[model samples]
Target: MIILYNLVLLVMRAGYNIAALFHNKARAFVTGRKDVFTKLGDYFRQNHAKVVWVHCASLGEFEQGRPLIESIKKEYPQTKILLTFFSPSGYEVRKNYDQADFIGYLPWDSAANAERFISIVKPTLAVFVKYEFWHHYAKALKQHQIPLLSVSSIFREEQMFFKPYGGFYRGILKNFSYFFVQNETSLHLLKSIGIDACAVAGDTRFDRVYAIVKQGGEIPVARQFKSDQKTFVVGSCWPEDFEVLTPLINENRIKFIIAPHEITETFMAAMESSLQVKSVRFSQAAGKPLEDYQVLIIDNIGMLSRLYRYGEFAFIGGAYGKGLHNILEAACYGVPIFFGNKDYEKYQEAVDLINRGGAFEVRDYTDLKAKYEMLNSPETFLLACEVTRLYVEENLGATEKIMHYCRTLLA
Candidate 1:
C-alpha cells in the first residue's frame, strides 16, 4: 500500500508537470526541488528566531487562520512566521501580510521534498488550517518531533477520511498533536477514528469578520445608494446569483450594492443589461462619488468581506453552484442574510443561521417575495436586523478558543 501511494505521488507529480504547460498553477509542480532547498537553505541560515510554520489550503482557510496569526504575532514577538499555501489564491493575496516573515507555495508533498523543506525551515511549531492533510508533510513533521496542530478543523462523513478506502489518509490524522475543530460533529468524527486529540474550537473566520464589522469603512459609492436608508449588499455573486436577484432590485423601497464574485467585463455587461435601473460598474465609477446610480455593481475584488459592514442585509453568492458564499462574513455584522438553496449542505453556517432565524434560504422567486415583503414592515425589518446582530455576538469567541490552543503549542 505504501509503495502504491509512492507510485500515485510520482504519477501525480508527472501529470501536474504536464498540466503546467497549460495552467499557471502547475508551475510549482515542475520546479527543481534542489533549487527550492537552496533558496530555503539561504533563508534558514540567517534566521535565528524560532519559526512557527502555518499552512492554509486557500483563501478561505487563510482567512480562518488570520486572527490566529495576528494573535501569535502579539504573543510571540520574537518568533518568525513561515506561512505556506498549497493554493495560488491564498499565496497571491496574502503574500504581503505583515505577520508572515516568509510566505510561499508549499513544495509538492513528496516524502523527499517534504523532508528537505521541513529540515531547512526547522519550524518549532506547525499549524494546519481547516481540512488540508498532506501525508508526507505530516509524516516529516512527526519524524522531527515537531508538534503538529490543526486550527478550525471541520470533518464530515462525505470526505476522504470516512471513505471505505481511506486507510492511508486516515492513518495521517494521528500525526496532529491537537485538532481544534469547528464543532462537535467534527470532534465526534475524529473520535470515531480513534484520533481524539480534538476540541470544538469553532472557526477563526468569525473572529476575523466580527473584527471587520466593528471597524467600519467608507463605501463612498455604496453610501450613495443607501443615503441614510437600509441597504443590502449582495456579495461575491456569480451570474446565476445575479440572474435570480436582478428582478428583485426593480422593486421599490430597497437599495442594493451588487458585488459579483467575478468582476470581468462580460459579467458587468450581463448585470447592466439585466437590471431595470441605471447601473454602473465599479471600475468605471471609481473616479465618481457615491450616488451616481441606484445600483452600484461592484466590479472589484478584495472589498466584499469589508463591504458587509455597510449593509443592513446581505445575500451571499455561490449557493447557485457548489456551495454558499461567505454568509459568516455578513453574519459577523449581525446582518440578516439570504441565498439560493442549491448547494445547501456544504455550508454549515447557513444551515445553522437559518435554523436560528438569523438567515433565510430562498427556495424560489415566490419564497423570496414573501420574505422580502415580511421585512418591508419597518418594525419587522428592524427586528430581523437585531436577530442578525445577536447571532454574530453569540458566535464571537471562536478566535479566543483557538488562540489559547495555539499558544500552548507555539514555541
Candidate 2:
C-alpha cells in the first residue's frame, strides 16, 4: 500500500505539472514548492529552536488549528512554531503570518520527502488539523518517537478507514498518539474500528471564533458602510449564492455587504450589474458618505470574519456548491444564518444552529424571501440571536481541552 501510495503521488505530481500550464492555481501549487526544502533547511539551520509542527490542509483547517497554535505559543514561548500547508490557499494567505516561526508548503507525501521533512524540522510535537492523514508523514514522525496528534477530527462510517477492505488506510490512524475529534459520533466510530486512542474535543473553530467575538468591535469602514442599518452580510458568496440573493436584495430594504469568495473583476462587475440599488466597492468607498449606497461590495480578502460584526443577519456561501464555509464566524456575533439547503451535513455547527432555530436553509429565492420576512420580525430575530449566542457560548474551550492533553504529553 505504501508503494502504491508513492506511485499515486508521482502521478498526481505529474498531473499537476501538466495542469500548471493552463491553470493559475495549479501553477501556484507547483511553483510554491519549487525550493521548499532548501528554504526550510536554511531556516532550520539558522535557528536551533525547539519546534512544534502544525500542518493544515487549507485556510479553513488553518482557522480550526489557529487557537491551539496560539495556546501552545503562550504556554511555551521559547518553542518555535513550524506551520505547513498542503493547499495554496492556506499558504498564500498565511505565508507571512507572524504567529508561526516558519511557514511553508508541505512537500509531496512520499516516504523520502516525509523522512527528510521530519529530519529537518525535528519537531518535538507534530499536530495535523482535521482531515489531513498522510501515511508517510505519520510513519516518519512515529519512527522518530515524536508525539503526533490529530485535532478537531471528524469521522463517518462511510469513510475508507471504516470500510471492510480498509486495513491499509486504517493503519494510518494507529500512528497518532491521540485523536481529538469533534463529536461523539466520531469517537464511537473510532471505538468501533478498535482505535481507542481518541477523545471528543469539540471543534477548535468555536474557540477561535469566540475569541474573535470578545476582541471584535468597530471596524471603522464596516461601521461606516453599515450606517447603523440592519445589515445583511453575504460572506464567501458564489454566483449560485447570488442567484437566490439577487431577488431578495431587489425586493427588500435591507443594506448589504457582499464578500465574494473570489474577487475577480468579472465577478465584481457581475455583482454590480445584478443589484438595482446603488452600490460601491469597498476599496473606493472611502471619503464618500457610505449611507448613499445600499450595497457595499468587499473587493478583497481577510476581513470577512470581522465584517460579520456589522451585520444583523448573514448568508454564508458554499453550502449550495461544494460545502459550507465557516458559519461559526457569523454565529459568534449572535446573528441568524441563512445558506443554501445542500451540504449542511458536513458542518455540525450548521446542523446544530438549524436545530436551535438560529439558522435556516433556503432552497431558492422564494424560500429565502420567506425566511427573511420571518426573521425580520423583532421578536423572531431576537430569539434567533439569543439561540446563536448560546450555541457559541456552549462550544467554547475545545482549544483549552486539547491543550491540556498536549501539555501532559509534552511534559
Candidate lDDT scores, in order, read: 0.80, 0.91
lDDT of 1 by residue, 1-411 (tens): 668878887898788779879987676435423266677788887788989888999888999888888888889998888888877777778879888888877887788888889878999989999888888899999999998989888898888787889888888898878898888899888888888778987878788887776776776766555677667789888888877787788775567888878778888887888778777766677666555466878876778877876778889888888678778778777677899988876677878877867788887667777897787788877777788778667767887887776676664
Q: Model 2, 1-411: lDDT tens per residue?
A: 767878888999999999999999999999999998999999897677678999999999999999999999888888899999999999999999888999999999978899999888889899999999999999999999999999999999999999999998999999999999999999999999899989998999999887777776667878987886889999999999998999888777799999999999999999899899989998998898888788899998888888998999999999889988889889988999999999888788999899999999999999998998998799999999999999988888899999998788555
- lDDT for model 2, please: 0.91
Q: For this target, which candidate reaches the highest lDDT against the unseen true structure?
A: 2
TM-score of each: 0.89, 0.89
Residue-level lDDT for 91 in candidate 2: 93
Clashing pairs in 1: 237-261, 334-388, 334-389
Off by over 4 Å in 1: 28-34, 163-166, 280-293, 377-383, 409-411
Q: Which stretches of candidate 2 lie above 4 Å from their native place?
A: 45-47, 220-229, 263-293, 299-302, 376-379, 409-411
Q: In candidate 2, residue 249 scores what lDDT? A: 84
